[model samples]
Target: MATSRDQTLSIVYSSTATRPLNDADLSALLAISRRNNARAEVTGMLLYRGGRFLQV
Candidate 1:
């Protein structure tokens, strides 16, 4: 019998928001990101702090 291995890849990145975003802006961003991610089979987390963003 033979065994097979699985392969996977990952990347991490961060960026700063060019402008301040209000509640509405944040909601819109989440909605758009969720749709796009679902289609791309991509899964990750997002963190917001002091106008900065970190995604992995």
Candidate 2:
């Protein structure tokens, strides 16, 4: 049997950045995202290329 807490939700989305992100900016953004997601017990992957972002 599976309880509500044992179920997990998954989401996938993509977006274009309004402004380009440099290496430093991208690194900082990823660091913050990792920290926050860890605190919320969430796991996923993020991809950035050509000023676009894809998160799953």
lDDT tens per residue, model 2, 1-56: 99977999999999999999999999999999999999999999999999999999
**Candidate 2 — worst ten consecutive residues by lDDT sum?**
2-11
Q: Give, for candidate 1, the lowest lDDT window spanning 10 residues.
A: 1-10
Residue runs of model 1 more than 4 Å from their true location after superposition: 1-6
> Residue by residue across 14-50, what tens digits does model 1's lDDT show?
9999999888988999999999999977789888778
Top candidate by TM-score: 2
Tell me the alpha-carbon RMSD of every candidate: 3.7, 1.1
TM-score of each: 0.82, 0.89
Error of model 1, residue 48, in angstroms: 1.1
Clash number for each model: 0, 0
Candidate 2: C-alpha RMSD after superposition = 1.1
Candidate 2 Cα outliers beyond 4 Å, as residue runs: none
